[model samples]
Target chain A: MSDKPESLTQADESALMQLREEIDRLDTEILALISKRANCAMKVAEVKMKASGNAGAVFYRPEREAQVLTSVMDRNPGPLGNEDMAKLFREIMSACLALEKPMEVAYLGPEGTFTQQAALKHFGQWVKTKPMPAIDEVFREVEAGACNYGVVPVENSSEGIVNHTLDTFITSNIKICGEVELRIHHHLLAGPNTKHDKISRIYSHQQSLAQCRKWLDAHMPHAERIAVSSNAEAAKRVQGEWNSAAIAGELAASLYDLEIVESKIEDSPDNSTRFLIIGTEQVGPSSEDKTSLVVSMRNEPGALYHLLKPFNEFGVDMTRLETRPSMTGNWTYVFFIDFAGHCEDESAIKVINAIRETAVDVKVLGSYPKGVL
Target chain B: MSDKPESLTQADESALMQLREEIDRLDTEILALISKRANCAMKVAEVKMKASGNAGAVFYRPEREAQVLTSVMDRNPGPLGNEDMAKLFREIMSACLALEKPMEVAYLGPEGTFTQQAALKHFGQWVKTKPMPAIDEVFREVEAGACNYGVVPVENSSEGIVNHTLDTFITSNIKICGEVELRIHHHLLAGPNTKHDKISRIYSHQQSLAQCRKWLDAHMPHAERIAVSSNAEAAKRVQGEWNSAAIAGELAASLYDLEIVESKIEDSPDNSTRFLIIGTEQVGPSSEDKTSLVVSMRNEPGALYHLLKPFNEFGVDMTRLETRPSMTGNWTYVFFIDFAGHCEDESAIKVINAIRETAVDVKVLGSYPKGVL
Candidate 1:
């Protein structure tokens, strides 16, 4: 559409307008295609509901979505990178999925948090999201069928593991349906009432404070740094105080109608978080899948060494192992493992069997498709 | 010392007083033992200095520390679990290690963040601590030898991975020296000038807001929730306002002279975080050790499968695999893997060799001692 010759004279002015018109026409065509796709998804949902004999049916197929995302990335003839291309497709699919059955996702929230961002990034904007107070509440809502799924932060590269979520997995029967990662960026925000020059205090979550430590030390040395529960809460606090500023992300700043005094205040640009989708139904294997497990071993020397023997013997590719305190057994630690292959895979099953033989206990948290966005 | 005869009612009072005296005596004995231990560590440091021909020497031995922690847990004969026992011993060792050279450590900080807590927990109160603004700076400080060691959060169970730290690993040559875990707790606090009845807004980090969502919804539903940079920052902000309350941890509350209005506000009782110790030198194998690596492969179908083959072949207990954008490659994803056994172990070396044969590139992110606290 942008096929105008370079170094053209005034004669090309009319042609430039024509090119823009061509772009507009193509955009309309794209919208038409999207509407058609959304219709197709609704039609598919009808079939799925009929198959299950009810309205409450598993409309979100992790495997199918994963396959679609993989296909999109594989086939993209993009000027953009594969991951970015996949992300665009993910949103399109998410919108179409919403047309079929709007997803109800529960997330850890007092409105704005990284977990909420992860949820939107993974599920897209078309779905209905409810903020749950805690990680456990997110799990419980999904388990009790209040929401189709729940989003929760599982670990942070800088923070290590969320032990509460790991502990929840020990007792809950919820499945891990999908996963998403979001890059974290913190900003320094202030309210409409605040005198910027007289700003004597700063508010933020502990992580954000740590993240922006150098920036604050250099720019606002006299400002007393205060820790809060979250960035969103900090944005709210600034609304009532003129001599106060809050360090948060774009989400909280926008949510509280605060102005960014400084942007990207996070010390490290690589700050990112990962979130998991928890649901009641077991997700089928995707083209490239990952399985999570909580494995327990007897308290003895070499127990950890022995517990992991099965993966090697059975050729199962283990991905992650986290040690959390076991609740009922003298506080011995349990390992949370993520590995390649789904639970239903033949090799994965064999590995599970081998682990069960020697391990004190084992729980397959879920097998979910790898993150495509 | 607690063993006084148990049957007589009136005599039990005297026995109880005797028990109290015994506890005091035991405490003094413990202080003396700790002093002696510190002296021993100092003597070792002197000997090391002599061995190294003066000023600078490698006084911190990760392998030795890991072994000591492991032994402490193994030999613990108590109602206190292995973790509690290890934690107590961890502080003891940290104190002793500090006496050797008064270890200088840097962490993401404003003093009250969990990273700071982790630093103190890992290095003991005797060490000289500094706060870095970002995870990368923590790495840089250690790389530049400006600090003896740097502590950063690598992953969180609830939030997944801190990509910034992982990204730092991709470019920096800093070694992973040790790991520590800390349980997290959040509290709602107000300062002296705060109006308890007129708190129309609550402030916290986004994570903390989410952690306490349910409680806020029920108790202070009308209070506008705001997010901030850190919980500590929120505490400071609340001090200058009467209509605001901040949610933070105990450390933050005390640091800014705030009183806790509500305690244990987190939704999950098991909230916790993990931190990593980064230093310049490669860590030797500990009694029970773990190693981490950043592995790259040609972007292809089943690339992950091929990449993980080595761990299975060598029976190395693979623990973690995080995918991040490869710094110099064609923007394909790279995997960060953590597994049982240190880099020096024969089996671990075999796994590394096998991986090297197939991998496009591999970076040995220094092996470290497991978390003792």
Candidate 2:
């Protein structure tokens, strides 16, 4: 109706104004409905917490949220597409969950790191954030009740598992309450004073620099590369320097007042990072869920196959399988497997028992509702 | 030796130089081994392609890379922590993959958009890149064979599926060969000459601005928010204006010579986008894999349960289950499921047949191997 090309015909203009007024009115109604929906989510969170017997259970259900948003999007109509509509609801739910119980989460410091991003995605703005200097510190904070939960990088789509996270799991008593997967995008950031000709050095967390290996090789082959503790830290060091740049996330650029010399500088465009949320409680079951376990096997050629045989025989599906070196023995390894089905299911229980009998040690890393996103 | 204190009387400058040379020599040897290892991956890729019938199979495997890097970290005595060590290996492998095969992919244009970043992560620098004006154009380019593959946003870990992508899937025969999930970080960028106080409008893709909802509410509550087609387009529009600022990716900032006024502006730090790699042929099995399918259910009270009964009874695991509006009928829905096995597996085939019998129609979208990341 607004597309009519008449040069402000009096009748057309008034009709257009009236239609706009009606749209504004409907938008206000939608805002109210959205507020109501958020409030309902708070109630849902409260019920979930009471049922699960865990105060922090309200946050981080990747699988559940995925299902919820999918249903919402399926039923949505009009100018807004399903994705657009779902995004609006995701924010609403995030805000609602925040209201249910505010959480405090800790991650490796400073800010704008992928780990920090993962924590936010899982917990939303409802949680307060504490940036720790190290992964161990994040664990300690959660263990000491300084934060409700801790987030640490477990793996990257391009780089693989963050070994520190896996090693920490081997030692820490903290449960893997939840997990969040994030896509990692690295940028080459420099200070406003930096001149392309004067640039001679690049700084970043070794991971960031590594992810952009090819880009560096092709574009800045002569520049010296230095590694730092975190991408944010690298950006901080490069601030006001004309001869240096830092490879980091956009947040680092803003946090350190740096300018982007280049963006999405990672070696691969589809790079992603997966993080684990450590806390004191296990997640209760939803309509769908996933269970993670760590199994140790003797140093033998067929040991890995023997452990996996039962899963195949029982028709249990394994989603993710990775082997980490066992700290206790030479050449020994701990295999971490994520499979469908809650631990409470009969088939899941049978498979776990079977694997446990064949393996030296089996650690159930906690069974949580799978995240939707 | 590098960590030895100067307390040793024999520790001299020349001794340090000699030690540095030795370390450098070892590094060269390590580089050669890495190069050799990378070459082997091409052979492995060849085997995989022959087995799976996909031409572009040689790429970085996140899980295997993680496992290998974790081993190195665990074995290190550590002047560097495990995190640092693993990070270095991640880059090494990423570089190796770049050598094996360069990829070229297409995404919605212009440069500095998150989709561009997503394309980079999946294809790396091994392939050429082409930017399309619309989502449909991306598919058309891939269809016309202008690019080997196309990367388009399928879903967000937090926000749900991109409906445009889903709608495209409905009409197009392109198979989803692989999937990449990326974490998105948005920034408020301005020209160096732009004054923060004078900024009157903020321009960005509507989706990006929405992702930063909370931040905008808290900071620029009154600033006029304008929607554009893409982040790069927003950046392009703000080139000479001192009163206008753009919220976009770091690439946009650099591409347009804009200063980042605020970074990591997304409400949740862990904002991630998931993309699908569309190609003519289905992907082959990897050491790690996931299979996606779409099944239609009759509109009944317990239709979902009936449809899922086969998976449960057959002990098949469903990783993801999403419902979409069916175009053929009113109130009927199509379910998208991601499971743990390739469609070729005996049990998977049985389950597919059973699901088809129970549902009105079942479309096996593609049963490709799961991503290693």
Best by lDDT: 1
List the DockQ of the predictions in order. Answer: 0.01, 0.01
* Tens digit of per-residue lDDT, candidate 2, span A1-373: 1122123445544654554354334333333333444444454444455544654343444445555566555554323334434443454445545566666899875554567767766765335776676788898898898787899888864345677777877777787777777766778888888897778999887777888899999999999999887776788889867799888876666556677777788887768777888876665565667888988898888898889988898889899898888999996789889999777778888899998887888888877656544
Tens-digit lDDT track of model 2 for B150-244? 87888853235777787677677777777766776788989989889888898888878888888988988878999887887899889978899
Give the whole-model CA lDDT for all candidates, comma-separated: 0.73, 0.68
lDDT of prediction 1: 0.73
Write model 1 residue lDDT over B1-373, tens digit each, in one string.
0121122244444543454344334333333334444455555555556545666667677776676667656665443345544554555556556556668999875444578768877875456777665789888888898999999987653344677888888888888888888777678889877767788999888877888899999889999998887776888898888899999866566556687788887888887887899988887766777888999888888888888887888888998777877878784678899998888888888888888887888889878877765
How far residue B8's Cα lies from its native spot in candidate 1, in Å, is 76
Off by over 4 Å in 2: A1-12, A31-66, A78-83, A144-146, A156-160, A189-247, A250-259, B1-373
Question: Could you give me the TM-score of model 2 versus the true structure?
Answer: 0.44
What's each prediction's TM-score?
A: 0.45, 0.44
Candidate 1, residues A120-149: lDDT per residue as tens digits? 778865567776657898988988989998
